[model samples]
Target: MTTPPFDPPSEADIATVSAQLGRPARNVLGIAARCVCGAPTVVATAPRLDDGTPFPTLYYLSHPAATAAMSDLEATQVMPVLQDLLATDETVRDAYRLAHETYLADREGIAVVPEIEGISAGGMPVRVKCLHALAAHSLAAGPGVNPIGDLALAQGDWSPLVCQCVDYNKDRASAGQ
Candidate 1:
């Protein structure tokens, strides 16, 4: 597999990702996607977390604005429509399946966990469960890999190209590292 399309996270990147998540960022292998302003938008997490829990979601959405936008789409019931499209459109289904395989390959390239074998995030290759995860995957992998992620992002009110970051440093809340 090609190298995971991400850079190893810096100290500041990890801290900012922690702040954006409102909790300590855990087991982040790399900065998957960043806001144009340089804050972490998505993080590449280890398949097995520090606590040894199996994490199927390799790309975790961290930016508050991006997450909020995806939440808005979910609130508006976009998942069912996307799910319907997956069911009816063979081309979409095929692309989604390829996306699942790609996700699995990427994650397994890092480290394999028997529990999450063949499983990918956001109900990929089958359903549309979490727009946050799907969008994160899209942002991390870039366009054309995940059609559902691309569609969710297109249907949402956010863009990675734009900067909508809040002053995370001002916040005092943290779930502890």
Candidate 2:
């Protein structure tokens, strides 16, 4: 596999990306957590949109070592790259691929799987789905959204039901229930 440019982001860049994306500080911190944990995948606590739509804001998959090696400065520097990655389909795929490879390399013997568990509210089992499909559907259904739809699909094998679950969560969050 071709090793992509492996530069991490800088702190300022991280702030820039966070501001540009309108993501919360905790989500940014989650990215740092993934880097520090050296795990195959790191999921950010979903963020709410300005209108209070709960959705998977970002997903970082990479070798724990590569992530761990990333300094705060590097993470900042990498923000633009990540923004670009999310902006284009090809770059998103590249980013996912690179992260997956890095994650595998970091955890050689570990078996990591992406999952979505149902959240309970009002005594109802609120189903949840993978973030990738929801992102794809959003990109396709709405114009001017980021072009990370395909990138989301490329990361794993997700089902429509899973996508529906994600959508439900987003809707619930938007509804403020």
Index of the highest-TM-score prediction: 1
Question: Please, what are the lDDT tens digits per residue for candidate 1 over residues 38-95?
Answer: 8889999999988889999999999887888999999998788999999999999999
In angstroms, give how far residue 41 of model 2 lies from its true place: 17
Work out the TM-score per prediction: 0.92, 0.22
Encode model 2's per-residue lDDT on 61-167: one tens digit a residue: 22222222233323345434544554465655554444333333322222221331222111111111233333323222332232333333333333222223334
- Cα lDDT of candidate 1 equals 0.88
Question: Highest lDDT: which candidate?
Answer: 1
Clash number for each model: 0, 18
Q: How many clashes (backbone atoms < 3 Å, residues ≥3 apart in a chain or on different chains) does model 2 have?
A: 18
Root-mean-square deviation of candidate 1: 3.3
TM-score of model number 2: 0.22
Q: Where is model 2 more than 4 Å wrong at Cα?
A: 1-6, 27-128, 131-177
